[model samples]
Target: MKNDTPKVFKSIFALFVVAIFMIGLFYAFVSMPKGWGVNVNNRVSRLYILKNVRTATRLLDSGKFFAKGMKPLRAEVPYKPIKFKKTANLEDGAANVVTSIVVDYRGFDTLGEVTVLFLAASGVMMLLFGKRVKPKRKKTEPSLIMYVGTRIAFAVIFLFGIYIFVHGHLTPGGGFPGGAVIASGILGLFLGRNGYTPNHAGLKVFESLSGIAFVIIGLIGLFSVKSFLANFLPTGIIGNLYSAGFISLIYIAIGMKVGSELAAVVDSMIGDTKEEWS
Candidate 1:
């Protein structure tokens, strides 16, 4: 009877959990509010110093003669100059800046994404090769590029990955894309050799350094600068390599860390696992 009571309690608890989960799922999908339109009553100020728009009604049939492409009228707040250092002048002569921002200026997002990649690689390794048992090794060598020349070619390819990362602030590609390219080099290495794995320890080292660099930079804002991500860097002459203060340094670190971590993760997935049991 005591055992029966315990079983009954367990069943009740399970049912209660299921019911709560079902209700939560129901509310999450069915009753979530999406603010589609502007709410005048809930105005929030911005640190970018932009001003509220006094009038935003379309100039339809008005005397103002805008150009051909200005027909589409829109309401927006007044523009204001954000209190940040200029990034126009950099040593690397690159035109595109959005990519630089993602890979260098806003590198926190990249770090989170790289961590996700690491977790994914670890999960794959655990799923396929964890708790290993004795199994027959597949003895056949892969007939793909196993030549010495191929490895030499891949060395150049890996260098190209580094080039991409280093020039990330100057070009369109940043950490994520550059990392993928670097991972391709490691993939070539894995395909060309037996049991060759990417450097996981090196990846950890690079990742830690990049994270520390980002934290130190953010800390500088607390003491030297007012805003959290305010670019207090000195803007050197535009169009010069290394001209953008701090941003250039930030991007290079992000590129190296991202490339190393991603390459290591992919290599681990493909090369580290042993032969599966039949």
Candidate 2:
């Protein structure tokens, strides 16, 4: 009876704690500013910010064109649209507005996507967990020309991936595609050799550091500008290499993180897990 009493008390205490936590969570959500769920389709700010339209019916519903006292202009007022190759010294000045939107405006969403991918990879690794066993039969090794060609191809593919992400703000491709390309190169390396496995410790360290750098950059924006993942750096001339400020930096971090993570996934899947059950 005494032992059962303690167990019952513990269960009740845990339930009480959980109830308090739920209440706090509800309050926190309710405290958020009204209009947080504003419809994206109705907002003129996003369209104008991207500079896709030469003329707009209205100004941004929120945000400073240059000052805060200015409220969003109604349709009656003429809103000056940004010109390509002409608009310099604008905030989030990537020539490719899509990149600006992805890495700047919707950065938190990007982080969530990365997190989801991480979770998926972790799940895969956990499901495939087992002791690696060498095959009883000797596998045929790759030919010399095939091995040499794969190494050369991997180097080219790897560099192309780096180039894609590095120039993400100026081009069509970004971190996700760039990382996938790099992973494809790593896959090539695996095919080149019968017994090739990437360094697990190195991949883990690289992935952790990349994720940390991403969060740190976001924190810097949050502290400096009072907005998470806000553009805090000076945006240079449009269409220039260094124009996009931290958007490029964020993409680089994302590229590294996604690349390392996918590489780790590949390693986990391909490692010898087949063991003869006695």
Which candidate gets the maximum TM-score versus the true structure?
2
Which stretch of 10 consecutive residues in model 2 shows the poorest summed lDDT? 57-66
Off by over 4 Å in 1: 1-94, 103-115, 118-122, 125-139, 142-145, 272-278
lDDT of 2 by residue, 60-122 (tens): 333324254545432323435677677787756887767887888789999999999999989
Kindly report which residue stretches of model 2 are placed more than 4 angstroms away from their true locations once superposed: 1-78, 274-278
lDDT of 2 at 60: 36
- The digit string of per-residue lDDT tens for model 1 on 187-278 reads 77777766665556777788778857766776686578665544557656544555545666666666766667666556545644456564
Best by lDDT: 2
Report the Cα RMSD per candidate.
Answer: 11.3, 10.8
- Assess every candidate by TM-score: 0.57, 0.73
